[model samples]
Target: MHVLLISQYFLPETGGTTNRVASLAKGLQSKGHDVVVITAKPSHPEGVIWEGYQDDGLVRDEQEGIPTVHTWVYADFEKTLFTRLCSYLSFMCSSVLGAVRERGSFDVILAFSPPLFVGLAGWITARLLNAEFVFDVRDLWPDLAVAMNELNGPVKIGLARWLEHFLYHRADAITAATDGFCESITSITGPDTPVQRVMNGTEPEVFRRDEAGKKLRKEGGFDDRFVVTYAGNIGICQGLDHILEAADRLAEDRSGVLFRFVGSGPVKDDLQREAKRRGLDNVEFHPRVSLDEAAAHMAAADALLVPLADHEIYRSFIPSKLFDSMAAGRPVLLSVDGEARSILEDAEAGRYYPAEDGQELASNIRWMLDHPEACTEMGENGRNYARTHCTREAQAERMTAFLEELIG
Candidate 1:
């Protein structure tokens, strides 16, 4: 089968969405399916485009040896609704043009969504090429926006919902990344549309514990302290201010535990300011790094932190970072509820603290510090569970079966 994978984010842009799509592309190619990708150049969490691909009309390239096309996007990282929509719409228009430029026919066009317009691009491309369309829902958009308070007023939200509904109904099949997403999509589309859960996973070989992280540990003077790290987009959804609160509490106790944040996002400056205001010296922030560097940082950590905003919509979110932490052979300091909590509990990889509860997070951190042997055992359990249940290779095979069924 020939596949065309469309996503706004891709390699050179480090994030969960990019990794998931890249993993899917590699998995499909390994199964002997011809795969291609259509994406924007590397610009994300930050609005600036990466250096090498700056001169762009429509750049053609090979990613992981898969034929790929890079289209133009209005790179805006601002929080305003208008700028955000402009970014999504620009990509939607350019991706369709990029698809037209490509030569071969596609059996399936798999599009990832969050900005939502990418699904429109894929649907348009599928119609033009006479191919089946598979809409991949990493998160429910307008609903999440509403829950996050990013979208308000009935008119704007109503229109977004209409667009989401149109895309779902047009798809030949809809694949959700979480079970909650599947149920929600099914509820919206009714029994007529097929909604399947594909899930997000990590590549264990890429994320496993390694000696390379010792460099970061030594350089950061973390060799003697217990380092708890959060490496990903430092965006609003992360609710990272709570981590600072926890750091402040630990500072009072002189717990010898360090909180590290390694990433960039819209809210990072605010978090930094808050930490400085609180005079929390135990917390440190680093700019984002390449995937290899990120894994190394994960390896250097005594425990990995996975946090989310306290809201109803987030209960369904199983952060890709959680899987990475598990694969890195590190115990997790989780601040989430529902589905993500279930994964941690089932794997016995970590302990959960209530979302936005800094006191509890600090208490959990202290517990880990006091019981080093238990933390080591928990880390081992997480690594073993990830190896057995959630490797990217297994996820790819599951996706292959879904796509093949859709094509048939």
Candidate 2:
């Protein structure tokens, strides 16, 4: 099968969306399919074009064996609604143009979403190519925007809904990354529309302990601390203020517990300001690192922190960083409710703290710090669970098979 995948973010810009698309492309190639990934020229989270992707033409490259085509997009820090919308629009326009350039070569087209405009590109490309259009729901778009209060008012919400439904109704198949997403998409597309829950996968090899990582941790002064690390987007959705509050409260009670935030996003400055205002010396902040570096930090930590805002809609969402933490054998201190919480509980991988509750989070930090043996056991459990059920290769194979069946 020839597959066309549209993702706004891809390799050279590491994160869940990039990782997932890259993994699937590799898996499809391994299974004897010609997969073409159309993405923006490697600028994300930070908004600076990555090295070598600065060429103004439609830059193309091959990773492992999969062919990737890159195109133009507005690469800027999405600090405001105007900037974000321009970035999204630019990517959407460029992705569609790139996909159209090689339109008729694919049997089926799949588009991942967040900047939902990629789905529009997929729809257009599929139509031109006379191919099946597959909408891969990484997160329910404008809904997440609305949930974060990022998109308000009837005019904006209605427009978002209209576009969302447009893609939902036109898709040949919808593959959701979560069961909750599957349910949500199903609610709109109705019972007849095909929706599959193809959850995110973890890379176990990268997350394991390593000597270089150990050296790096010692260099970072993490060797003496019982670190609780959060290594991902420092955004509004993360609700990181809770982590800061927890750090403030546990300053004296659990002086050994250090909250290390190792990532960057729009909310990062605000978070740092709040942390300073509260005079929280136990909290440390680091700029976002490469995927390997993130895993190393997680492996060095005694526990990993995953938090989501206290919004009801977020319950359906599970950030990909959690799987990385679990694979690293770091006991999780989860501040989430819903599918993510259920997964943690079922795996018995970590302890949960009530979301946005600083006191509960502080208590859990103390518990983990005090119960070293128990945390170690939980880490082992998490490693086993991740290895058994979430290996990227295995899940990628499943996704490929699903796509094959859908195309057939």
Candidate 3:
């Protein structure tokens, strides 16, 4: 089968979305399916194009053995609404034009969403090529936006719902990253809508704990202090300020608990300011690294920090960081609730704190520091669970089955 996979973000962009899309395309290609990935030219969370990579026009490249089509987008993670809209719109218009111009036929068109407008292009492309459409709901878009208070006003919300339904109804098959997402789509599109759960997972072969991880910590300036690490986009939905506040509560502790944040986003500067204001000297911040690098840091840390904004939408969000943490064989300090909590509790992976409660998080951190035996056991359990159940190779095979079913 031939596939045209479309997403706004792809490899080298640090996030679960990047891993999910790129890994699947490569996996399909390995299985003899011709896959062409259409994406923006590497500009992501920061919004600017990747260094040394200019987006002058449509660029062609190969990513993990799969052919790639790069479209120009007004990419920038500007705070203003207009600027962000332009970023999304440029990608949508350019991708549609590129899809139409590309010569050839495809068996299926897989569309990933967050900037839901891109689904329109996917639907259009599928119709244009008379191909099947598969919508991958990685994030429940406008609904998630509404819960995060990013989207408001009845008019806009109504239109977003309409768009979402239109695309879902048109899709020959829909795959969501979690059961919560599957339920959400089924509720809207009815029980008959073909919805499956193809969770976000990492390549186990690439992410594992080894002696080199310990060497990495020493080389990266980390020492014997008990380290609690949070590595990902420091965006608003992350509620990273709570982590800084938690650090404040432990400021006087002589146990040598060090908090480290990795990755860049809209709120990195503010979190730094808040940490400084509180005079917390134990906290350190680092820029984002590639996926393998992130795994190395996670493996080296004594414990991993998994947090999310305290909101209804986040209840359904299983932070992809949890899966990565498990792969690193580190006990997690989970600060979110609902689906994420269930996963950690069932895996016996780590302890959880009340959402948005820095004092609770602080207490949990201290507990994690003192109970080395428990942490070690929890980390082992997490690693076993991740290896046994969730793996990139397995997810790709499941997705392939869905494609074949839909195409037939």
Model 1 reaches what TM-score against the true structure? 0.97
Supply candidate 3's per-residue lDDT for 77. Answer: 68
Question: Per-prediction TM-score, please?
Answer: 0.97, 0.97, 0.96
Q: How many residue pairs clash in all the candidates, one count each?
A: 0, 0, 0
Per-residue CA lDDT of model 3 for 1-408, tens digit only, reads: 989998988765658887888889877877789888888878777777877468477888777766888888887667666776787788888888888878889999999997887888788889989999889988898878887677889998999899999999988889998889999899888977799999887676566855767987788676778889998988888877888788888878744878889898888998898888888898999889887787777877999988888887888778878888887888998977888899899999999997788899989988887899999999999888888887887899899888888777
Off by over 4 Å in 2: none
Residue 368 local lDDT, model 2: 79
**Native-vs-model 2 lDDT?**
0.86
State the weakest 10-residue window (summed lDDT) of model 2. Answer: 209-218
What's the lDDT for all of these models? 0.88, 0.86, 0.84
lDDT of 3 at 45: 73
Candidates ranked, most accurate by lDDT first: 1, 2, 3
Scored by lDDT, model 3 comes in at 0.84
> Could you tell me which residue pairs clash in candidate 1?
none
lDDT of 1 by residue, 240-327 (tens): 8889888989996756889889988889999999999999889899999988899999999999999998988899889988898999
For residues 18-133, what per-residue lDDT tens digits would candidate 2 score against the true structure?
88888999999898998899999987777788888888889988865668899998878766777888888998888888888864478889998977888998898889888899
Residue 244 error for model 2, in Å? 1.2
Q: Return the clash pairs for model 3, or none.
A: none
Best by lDDT: 1
